[model samples]
Target chain A: MVKFFHHALKFRKDVCIGCSHCMNECPTQAIRIHGGKAELTDNRCIDCGKCYMVCPVGAIIVEADDLSRIFDYTHRVALIPNILLGQFPEGVSISQICSVLMEAGFTHIFEVEHGTRVLEDAMTKMMEEKELPRPLISTFCPAIVRLIQVRFPMFTDNLMLLKAPLDIAAMYYRRKLEEEGISPEDTGVFYITPCAAKIAAIKSPVGEESSPITGVINMDFIYNKIYTKVKQGLSGKGSCCLPAMQPLQPEEMVWSLTEGEAARMPGRTLAIDEVSNVIEFLEKMENEEISDIDFLELRACDQSCAGGILTSGNRFFTVERLRKRAEEAARGNDSMIYDTAGDSIRDHFDYLNEHLKVTQIKPRAMDKLDEDMEQAMLKMRKVQEIMKDLPYVDCGICGSPTCNSLAEDIVQGKAHVNQCIYVQKRWEQEGKLQPKESMEILKEIWGEDKF
Target chain B: MAERMQFEYNVDGGNFTRAGFASSEIKKILKKLNVDIGIVKRTVVATYEGEVNIVAHAYSGTIYVDIDTERIRINLKDEGPGIPDIDQAMEEGYSTASSQVREMGFGAGMGLPNMKKNADEMHITSEVDKGTEVEIVMFLNNKE
Candidate 1:
């Protein structure tokens, strides 16, 4: 059986050292070291970029659309998240960044958070429907959505069936352009993404049939392009060509930070950041050890999107900067320029709301040993039987994260029982396996060079 | 096939931090065995409530789990102050836990009731000043 799962984080075999760092650090146990290279299990990987963070040799790469793809459309719109503004230092003004994007050939720049205004009202309406399940999990972070689908399949219904802000923003822009006499083919909406999951979500969305956004540009790539222009003093001169900017409200400005959505949600809501923290909390929630939570805002990154793997700035400093900006917006002391053209998102609220909902998300659980119950039971018994001979110590020398995982692999015929160093040592002591034979197995796993 | 798998886990009483360990292990095993998710949720909830009861009231306890193709049975036996009246103890609001345990959010009077609600079959037996044994059985194939 073939299972197709779109993953944005790519593992390059030539660059991997097979050091086991990525294999050990993966939260989903999606990576394995074999033949001196790291292999990613497609269905198991959530594209959370955890392995990308730990790879010392830069073997993992985040695939994004090339910048030149924007030029294909006559109306090029850059849909940027609020975190992009946080990536800049205080000395770099918002207008400077917009001017750089405009100089780089973007016809219009829109803040992705502007769509949150439409979402706030829709979410309030959703909370009013008591028939929905309690603790409605936010679908804000794509990685968290995928995590729930694969790891906690029981909670798939708990996910909010609503489009993310990026989707809303992209849809609104595309429709707005269509109304203005520009064809959909001529209007290209590009999202500046902070993580690989967002890129994957756009490429092959979970609950949605298709994405409105035309392409994706990594935030780091755009940050470098803008910063270099600012340092060269070219951004200030290009401010004359800056389009009328839409000033984001204080709440919308901080909508991607931790507790951003939870603060706005009605009832007893809780926001959890970091993937491991979310996993631990969900485990207890699944066990019914915790209850009465009306809403849950779960993010895959630690500081939310500020800790995105593609972000270039320090997560803490970026959070602090965004918070300060939000305070300024709240106080009406924000010096950023606003567009008087009255092309506000509020004007297109009805149109955006009509397309706000996503379809029901189906669970794609990765835990079962087999599709059939009897076969799974047989596989489970085989794993348990193999586990009796192997030490429980989670030494990753076997290329699997834990001994239990190695046992599972052995049952599935992906690995051999002799791949375990402890089992090999025991067999050698018993004279059942020769040293030369064990060394050959190590060479097969770690490559001929590691010996 | 009528094959069965049995496993044992020790539960340390008065340690609320380690209360749900056994339930988590059982949940993992059931998930790997391709049990229905609805069945998994009910079994885990029933097992968790029983585990917490052992930690909240007993001195120490042991959980014995038996899994077959059709059902999952868990037996939680604890050595501690046994209940004098099983009828009163089964009530939702009746708890003999100390104020400290209540403050720590453990000794909720709902433990037994919750276990009964999630499990397909539940039985409790106790001897005064001796110990308590709780057995919970959940059907894997037929879920309500």
Candidate 2:
């Protein structure tokens, strides 16, 4: 199988229970059952990590960056997700979390929400200038970017030129270090991500520009370590402070929640969460029905990034916690970190002055069944003809993802119609299959073994 | 094996949720057949607009799909009050959709124009208080 996207996810075939959960849940229908085991067809995979989320037996795993590599860089900057602030207990301050992370061996801490604020400012500028395409699509979620690249290639123009917030944070941190006499090769920017798709993005960014991230750290992997470190009083003995940049606003912190972006953009906007829902919306968007809208945010996770596969807490609980925290922060209950009264916070843009992203990206289509348009049309007509005869139940008993998949597999000579249980039963009732034919099927499935 | 395939679907009117079902099915079939994605996308746009037109305007309708090696022709016929002025209805922003259908994002008067834009050939004939029939033909071999 061809290597799809970045190999951000690893598979352990030893623990696979052959439940087919991952196969059925895949949005791209990339997984198929072969010889009672699940196999991924890398050509169609967008590396969305739904298979990793759906695997019940712990067979599918995301490849986590080795924490030991962080020591190799002279300056190691950790980028924290806003959702992580809500993952902690009710009383833990942002300073406390940063202190614990610093104690845990990080040289500098950069909040992902700061990157979000930067993007909001840039996007606001773009909106005011009308520089971007209408109905601007967000690149916050890497899975959504890959989805658009693979499935909705025609909507590539609608995608906003801005990269993910982590990318922005990494760029900011690296530039600041580079100006301070630190080389790019000597400085590391680590993103504590909540999903495999972000890891994929860190490995291979959407545009032609190089990825800014040096290492991809899984959130849930270090959740308990940070919790224990904070509980044991390893750091934050008193009120702590940060002199780097400003803290995230209430509206900015909730960007991980569903419709969080739309809540800020007051217009005919649309927000869709969940992979299937986003796919449907993208299909509709591809038809150009959403031109009346200004912004469209499509998230692949259940409750946006808060409900990611690597998150330790439930999505609803995290959102509720964030809501309460945002309320308290609004009332000035939380301790202040960054020096908001001085001009130092305003100098944050100085970091991006020389490192602003300037690149172009074109559509990278997944695959074409046939190269010739006329031959492709003939193939489609043939699929329509084949589909009329098969059962329309979409039963995955044939080892394909859907009945349409089975039809394609048959046409591609990868599968036979007899693999369908319904076909087998009908054949048996009609005396179409002899004892010899049944043995042939057994040999095909289990290999030349006498039973 | 059927060298030439034709699919017929009866589109029930007033079922907004199910309006795109036939078109979605057609998309899946076209995708499975390995059709050019651009052509598949155009066919889906035209076919879906036609299907939605039936669900939003007509009481009941029948859609016939004729596919060969060269083209996929979709003809939609409905049994309901038809457009009185076909030219006026063809114009952009000219809609007779009720507030209920418009609120559901079904009718923006972009259906016929979009169908015409996507399909290589389009023909619409209607009679007042009778019914309307729409035919869209998309060439499979065209680059545009």
Q: Give the best candidate by DockQ.
A: 1
Flag clash pairs in model 2. A379-B33, A380-B33
For residue A370, model 1's alpha carbon misses the true position, in angstroms, by 2.0
TM-score for candidate 2, residues paired by index: 0.88
As a whole number from 0 to 100, the lDDT of residue A398 in candidate 2 is: 76
lDDT per residue for candidate 2 within B20-69, as digits (tens), equals 87887777656545566678878888888999999998899999998876
- Residue range with the least summed lDDT across 10 consecutive positions in model 2 chain A: A442-451
Model 1: CAPRI class: medium
TM-score of chain B of each: 0.95, 0.95
lDDT of each: 0.90, 0.76
Tens-digit lDDT string for candidate 2 (A1-451)? 4454775777676777666888899998888876556788765677678898878888988887877778998788888888887787767767788777776678877777766766776666656656666787777787887787777766677777776677777777777777788888989888898898888877877674688888988898767777887788776774443545655677767877888777766457888999999998876665554458888888999988888888988788888988886777777764547665633323676565344453555655654555554565566666667787689888787778788888778876788888766777778878997656865764454334324
Reference interface contacts recovered per candidate: 0.70, 0.23
lDDT of 1 by residue, A264-341 (tens): 999999999999999999999988888999999999999999999999999999999999999998998775677657
- In model 1, how large is the Cα lDDT of residue A81? 92
Screening candidate 1 with a backbone cut-off below 3 angstroms (N, C-alpha, C), the clashing residue pairs are none
